[model samples]
Target: MARLIDLSIDSDQVIQHLKHEVKLKTVYQSILCKQIIEKASQERGITVEPEEVQAEADQFRYDHKLESASQTLEWLEDNLLTPDDWEAGIYDQLLKKKLADSLFGKQIEAYFAQSKVQYEQAVLYRILVPYSALAQEIFYQVEEEEISFFEAAHLYNIDEYRRLACGFEGKVSRWQLKPDVAAYVFGAHPREVIGPIQSGHDFELLMVEEFIPAELTNDVRQQISSQLFDEWLESELNHLVYSQ
Candidate 1:
């Protein structure tokens, strides 16, 4: 024979709140995503300072017009989250970003060092002649070197931007050009005609008018560093997320 046990009754309001149901699997996954973030954050020696959290929370509240953090928590809970979950998400994001910075920060400096000449500012004159009978005629004139690139551009180019600057497209980076274009622009002796180059549906002629090498400008290094960090973060995050 077994003995029966009785449980105490709670107030109706308490019972109603307690009855709020959430999916077991969702709760479990939320816990897992939370743990991953915490572990990653700890590995990086990052602390989500109170002021920072508060600032984020304050902004969240202001954006959503929520009364307080507590309300925010309740809303999150209703959407299947806890405060821990939110904090973990934030921690993971910040820590991942920081780790990326630490990892890729040096590479950016190296990149800037090696590619400084490639980022040199230049004034270019270009003529875009459609693939037609006129193309060979224009190409011949430019190739003969009898007429200057500027003269050819003024005579035959139809692109309005070229017309305005007397065919000058100022301050371009070699990396910004297509592989073929970069080769031509950087490989040529300065002031030489570079192309009857195929570009999309047209043929182009280009000449480098002037070039200014990239100086060690303020914040340029930082900008490159930040970009590198972002790239690293994306790669790392992709690995992490896909690994599981």
Candidate 2:
């Protein structure tokens, strides 16, 4: 028998190329998710389905106030897509949502029970005034109660609309606020005014207008549950495919 010569490329370089190719293929498959959706749609005998497509297209038009589907198609063409590609994209999104629902619907319900505390809301107020002489003046006036928070914010805050609204950040959870802001707002006594504190370039003043400790509202609970299930499923899928 003839001896086989080991003349192949270096094992390390081959492995690196394989890894790189896998990464590239992952990106291509993400693009091809739309193709998968188009194929599935056709397989389900959903042809001549202009009504469904039009409903989707109409919603997109209304949301964006586009004049017609042809106009939408033109825009997509400019961006390197066809009308069918747009339909495929929509179908792909719908299919993924259905898959998520099917796979984790029960898990999501269980998650809602376990994660109730994460779903509460709170009432908040904020003022973002320019970090200038006017802001400092407004801060002092509020501090001394020389002017009402609303009055000072209306006169001096940089953001025109919030100034009009008297700086109502409205009901927001601790997670919604920046870490530093959340810490101060949630930890402070209710109805307490906090800050001339820095947020980016501006000075922000916050008050805990009202506090509502976590309550399991159906909508909020469902959202939290869905998120938790998604995270768990992602981890499990990753492990099954890639774990050593």
- Return the top candidate by TM-score: 2
TM-score of each: 0.52, 0.61
Tens digits of lDDT, candidate 1, 1-244: 1112354434554445445654554555545655554565578686667667667766777888888667887778655566777776665666655654655656766788877866666667788878756666776776787776777777777887786565777767775787778888877777877777888888887888776678656455666666676554456556766797
Using lDDT, give the best candidate's number: 1
Model 2 residue 203 CA deviation in Å: 3.2
Model 2 stretches with alpha carbons more than 4 Å out = 1-55, 78-80, 129-140, 159-161, 187-191, 212-222, 229-244
Point out where model 1 deviates above 4 Å: 1-107, 142-148, 219-223
lDDT of 2 by residue, 1-244 (tens): 1112444456566557768777755654445544443454566644434566668767887887778767787677555566788887665555555544555656755665665444456687778876755566766777788988877767766788888888876778655667776778878776567777887787887777678877656666456646754565556555545654
lDDT against the true structure, per candidate, is 0.68, 0.66
Could you tell me the lDDT of residue 40 within candidate 2?
A: 45
